[model samples]
Target chain A: MAEKVTISTVAQHAQVSRQTVSNVLNSPDVVREDTRRRVLDAIEALGYRTNRAARQMRTGRSQLIAVRIEPTRDGINGSVLDRFLHGLTDAAATAGYRVMLYTAAGPADEIATYDDLLSSYELDAFVLTGTDHGDVRTEWLAARGVQFVTFGRPWDNPERHLWVDVDGASGTAHATDHLIAAGHRRIGFIGWPAGSGVGDDRRAGWARAMRDAGLEPAAALDRQTPDGIAQGESVAGDLLRGDAPPTALVCASDSLALGALQAVRAAGATVAVTGFDDTPVARAVGLTSVSQPLAEAAAGCMDLLASALDGDHAALGHRIGPMLLQPTLVVRQSA
Target chain B: MAEKVTISTVAQHAQVSRQTVSNVLNSPDVVREDTRRRVLDAIEALGYRTNRAARQMRTGRSQLIAVRIEPTRDGINGSVLDRFLHGLTDAAATAGYRVMLYTAAGPADEIATYDDLLSSYELDAFVLTGTDHGDVRTEWLAARGVQFVTFGRPWDNPERHLWVDVDGASGTAHATDHLIAAGHRRIGFIGWPAGSGVGDDRRAGWARAMRDAGLEPAAALDRQTPDGIAQGESVAGDLLRGDAPPTALVCASDSLALGALQAVRAAGATVAVTGFDDTPVARAVGLTSVSQPLAEAAAGCMDLLASALDGDHAALGHRIGPMLLQPTLVVRQSA
Candidate 1:
């Protein structure tokens, strides 16, 4: 076995004091650039690794961010979170943080998991996803003064904490406007049942776009079901077979849009369809959809969390507003 | 904020010594069942979290498993890793471990990341994915005597380390056998370019199955291109347009099958197409695909890792053989 490399080895190799080596690894800014580069080179040559546990015990910062790995729901839409996580991991690495993943049954279970993580790991902060109205996870973290940021907006108290969200309403509105421009007068919407903040926001965008274009978004043309391709197909089949069937459909998700496309094909009807999230399935099937700037959102979340961890409470308070990124409308054959 | 709870607080509340509380949390087997229960109840009441950094400093076990989060490649097949990650997180929790994620450009970069993770975090073990011919990641970890397991087989040195792999050859063979049983004498294969262990394994299955059935596995009917829907479409289209084209196509991945499905539709050809991975896209499009038991594989990996960490070197040596899990062929309308 190879000899174990330690800080003393690195210091000896670099001809520096132990404190200088420690400073280079922990607080590089405090060391001279030449000295720091020499120490780093020696450490790299010796393959010296800092003991993070000891550092955490001293500094109370693990340089780890906790996030829940949600179960794969309807497989089609599940890729959205997967992509976001990829983006988050990349962004976190750039910010000198690693992502730690956990699985929980629901919000209550998630809160419990957070408690366990905080008690055991002393994680630097958390980057949460799937935020919704009456979210207990955010409240628990905020009450305990845990530094955190969410990928979704806090619907009830947007200003309470840092959050980065894509404008779903804007995304759906763009899809609707595109269809309206393409000579679709009677357009239908397929979405989840109301009460979800995200769902309501998406439906509102479709409604607003219709009203702006002086088209009636009649309740008859709007269909609601839990997000699924089969459900999308079933609901869309009924709408296509109904009186004054829609000339196009704006779906809340790629899963629903794929289903709607199937229904359109099954009905042998030419109905334009647009889906949200611009999932790969949508791309594979040539469906026009709305795309979120997931990488940007991830970077934004990291930036906000960095500020929160910087301990600049006054500046953080002033920067408490939500960061909403616009979604792009990806034009494809379906629309 | 409420008063901070410590080991001492739990000890006082449970009417036990601090060492007893520590034993209950770390080594429950050393404490009586009734005493462990009392300590746990007190912990629940006070919300006491173990200082993991201190514990790690004392025991050298962070109970963290590191895994690389690969970039989202060709969106259609990316869900496979996502599902695997979900499964791994769930299974790791059950095994009293947490999953930490990192990203790297390629094998060398991943090795560097591993060094960083090991030096700083002291991760208990790594769960690697995307193993292939001459995989340096596995070699580096093995050389260091790191406790780790891979979600892929080491193609070159199969018996060198611990791994859990889905039998890709068997999966494609089943798909081929299904087509042959349905009286499809001419079966075409669409896969990635040669040299990839996984792709080659999948192709080998089809060839073996064809020869076993006394059918000619002709080179003219086999095509290789990068894995993508468009690539699959282009390759499958050429095969379909060729002289005496196959009545069925077996693809290495769902993405390719999806493309082949498009080519079949475009050619107006009555062809059966099967995909591997049984990704959500395949399910949504009703493509027959091979499904790897991801959760079971995850559990298998965790079980092996737990054994490796249990310090039972003799038993672990006997259990060092690779765990090859069977893939289930999920039949749908595509085939």
Candidate 2:
């Protein structure tokens, strides 16, 4: 077997101390540019390999990020998750990190998976998504002093933890305002059953928009249903037959909007509709929807998580901004 | 901070040698039940965490599988890839292994990625998909003497590597036979542009089934074009305009099948169409298609890869069967 290259060999070749070689690899700014270049050249010449496992044992850093995903047969928003995964993966790669995907049946399984992964591997940090109220995963991770950043905000307790989420309320508010401006006063909202952190936030946006326009957001105009095409179609039919039918329908997701469009076509009625996530289905059908700046959000997520993983938690603590990103309205013929 | 527990500590506590402690952990079957139980109890009492870094340096194993996927926006078969990923991940998790996902720009970029990952981390093996003739990734990995298994069988160099793939020919043949059995002898075939290994294999199946039935497989009855719903619709329209319009269509993908359906509907004609992959759209619209046994394929892949990862290559070399899994015919309303 060939002799493995070591930092001491590179140090000796470059006529520098071992710490200088280490600084060139990990904290390049601490080393002079000429010295860093010389050390790097020596490393390349000798084919120096970083003993990541050894460094991990000493520093407790793996340069691996754990992203928990629900490998369900029917995810609520498959495309959104795919896009987020893509963005997060690409961004993590740019930061010299790799993503380890672990699937769970549900929230409890997710917590257990985290525990197993943390103990089995030296994972630097975790990226949590699909968060809801009183999330046990978040509580468990926080209690164990494990560093993690939730893709969705900490809805119940947001004071201590780091998080980044697209502002659902802001997105729906924009959509509702656009519909109202287009001369639609009786607008209805279709969303998931109330109490979902994101769903409720989106509903609140519509309510706020109506109030701003000096219009009473009628209770009868709002319908809450589980997320599915059939559910959306069924509830939309009922909403359309009410005493005062809504002229425009705003949904918490594209799935609901597509269903509402089906109902509209079946009833031979013309009503503008808006969807969320701006999934491929929305674009294919030309439905006006809110498109979350997922790539930007991912970059932000990598920034926060990378800082923590790089052992710069003090710098992360001082950084301030709304981690909530504003989703833009992609106007189409649907609304 | 507490003192770090090691195998030496467990050995002392269990009144056994260090090698015996290692045996209890790695090769438990060789250790007597009583000794194994004693070692386990000591491990539990002392909270002895295995030093993965030390073991990795000793064994040069990372227990991580690299599944390279092109994070493209318009994946030719996104849903198929997604299902395959789900299967691979779930099966890998069962074997106490984790999946590390990395994205690449193209085939050349993919090879470069494998090199970078191999040099940086102690990745045990790689899972290659979307392979083509003269694949550079395969050649590079093979040349470097790295362990890998291609999801798609090598079209050019089958004997030089390990692979697991769905039997595309079997799937299309089954679909053709079903259509023929349904009293539709004049079945038309739609597939991607010829020369694609999978596409050609699928087309050959339709030809084989027709030849077996003592029916002439007319070249004029088949259409080969790029994969897209619009293209499928356009080509189906062209095929339907022929003097001998087929009674049914067997498409290589659900996208093509959907387009064929649109053409049939527009022509005010009734015709059955079978698609491949049985994607969600196919199920929603009730299109009969061939459904690959992805889970089985994934299990097979994990079994082979796990054995290699476990340093039991001798067993893998002797195990034999057709790696090409036969897909099943999912009967839906369309056909």
Candidate 3:
């Protein structure tokens, strides 16, 4: 068997304390961008394989990853959850990990979910999603020394917890810039609620992109629509009906953009529209949108979680850039 | 510690032989329906649980469930593959199983794929989709004593092996019945290649419903051009150009359905559109369609797989009914 290189090896190689190496690993998003790049470079160069949390898995108990999925009640389980698992399962298989589904009724079910995973040695980590500001789950996990990574950023500056999230700012930037490049000036944005980190980041990106282009974005206060296309359409409809409507619209989600398209068409407006997450709906409609490499993100989580299983929480945080996948401006007549 | 239950306990409780119980577990689809139901009742009544496959798991070895994700990569990993994993993964997790993604470069790569898994201890079974007649992969796995199932059915007979799939027949039936209820007599069908397991089942249901209503079914051939929406739109256009164009159209997928709607709108035709799978695209466009319970189907796969893991391949073949899931007549302006 090959001698596994780990955090200690990387620390030694970088001529730093293991704690520093851990910090670099845990909070790369917070690390100065240059410092973050240096640490990541070292990680790749050193061949430091993540140490498996050997006890739970070595005990011959199948290690389970608690993947909290929106139950069928929410339309999320159909395709969104499905795509995530495709990446997650493939990555997990490589590390001899399997995912157990945790379906929550709502925010209240979150506590019970943690309790269930805690009781079982079968689970080594939790992959949380749909988190918001002031997230109680992150607080609980941090307090109990549980191994976890919330898919999106939590409201609080979570304490050196491991996470794999899309750089929503960049994703939104990609969408906004595309519109600007296509000779769209009076562009409007379809925003999500102010609570989510992704929503805020995306909104910020759109605003910044507008400011950068020497253009004034529409005075929309980020339409606080819920997840799904219906909300997108409803909000876009309101924007389209108003006098002095913008020539282009930006949505936080591809699903939402679909809604925006309907709104744009229904109001008999010749407006262009774009979205984020480059889902199948986006591709099917040729909606220009940013694509997040979710499979790779899911794989990165496994690489981090496996190290966390070794009792080194600080070795798990990974803040990779949302892959700058080229968002092709599919010039369908609708857009 | 609580005593674990085994196949023998289930057999004894069900008043059946161990082999009968094994057969019931291995090929649930083959067992008498009444007997199978009784066995399930007995297993539940006895609180019997199967042994976890921890033997191979100790060394981090695993049963590679060869998941065929037909890399249909047009820069996007296949969406259908993503959704299927939502169920396949959750089910595998419970049995301490893992799925290895087998990205077939093309149909040629399909035949020798299992050799890699066999040598790597990465695969113990295969879950297939987009299967056609004379698939060598299915034949290869059957010869290797590897457990197997197909999401899509093959053109061959029942003697080959086992599989559990979405009830496409019911999905199409629901769509057809919905259109018929909406006062549409001349209903057309725009679909994929005919005799495809997915295509055939949906067509069968549509035909049955059309015959029942004393209405002639529209052309059942693949009207789609190679590309997605353009194909649907052109087919729809062709159908509209026909002497007796249908008042409604039943499509194989939401993508096709979306195209049909675009074509209908583009031609200024008055035909309503209905589709299967109820993909997010269907909802966004408000095209009334039948939705398969993807989550439930995922759960069903897990249940059968759990039985298969227990060395009961017979009971693993039980058919889960395709849920109609209250297909709404989304009554949008087009429909």
Task: Give the backbone clash total of model 2.
Answer: 0
Query: Predictions ranked by TM-score, top down?
Result: 1, 2, 3
Q: Model 3: residues >4 Å from true position, as ranges?
A: A1-165, A174-188, A213-220, A237-248, A261-272, A284-288, A293-335, B1-81, B89-127, B153-155, B170-187, B207-227, B242-248, B308-335
lDDT of 3 by residue, A80-144 (tens): 45566657766775575655555455665566546533432235678887667777877787787
**Can you write out model 2's per-residue Cα lDDT over B175-219, one digit (the tens) per residue?**
999989999989999999999888999999999999999877788
Model 2, runs deviating above 4 Å: A1-41, A44-60, A157-159, A181-183, A262-272, A283-288, A311-322, A331-335, B1-41, B44-60, B181-185, B241-247, B261-271, B284-286, B311-322
After TM-score superposition, the amount by which residue A299's alpha carbon in candidate 2 deviates from its true location, in angstroms, is 2.2
Q: What are the per-residue Cα lDDT tens digits for candidate 3 across B173-215?
A: 7778877888988777777766566677777877888888997
TM-score of the second chain in each model? 0.85, 0.83, 0.73
| Candidate 2: share of reference interface contacts reproduced | 0.34
The TM-scores of all predictions, comma-separated, are: 0.87, 0.80, 0.63
Query: Candidates' DockQ values?
Result: 0.45, 0.28, 0.08
Candidate 1 yields a Cα-based lDDT of 0.85
Give the per-residue Cα lDDT of candidate 3 at A221.
Answer: 31
Superior by TM-score: candidate 2 or candidate 3: 2
Interface CA RMSD, all predictions:
5.9, 7.8, 11.5
Rank all candidate structures by their DockQ, best first, as comma-separated numbers. 1, 2, 3
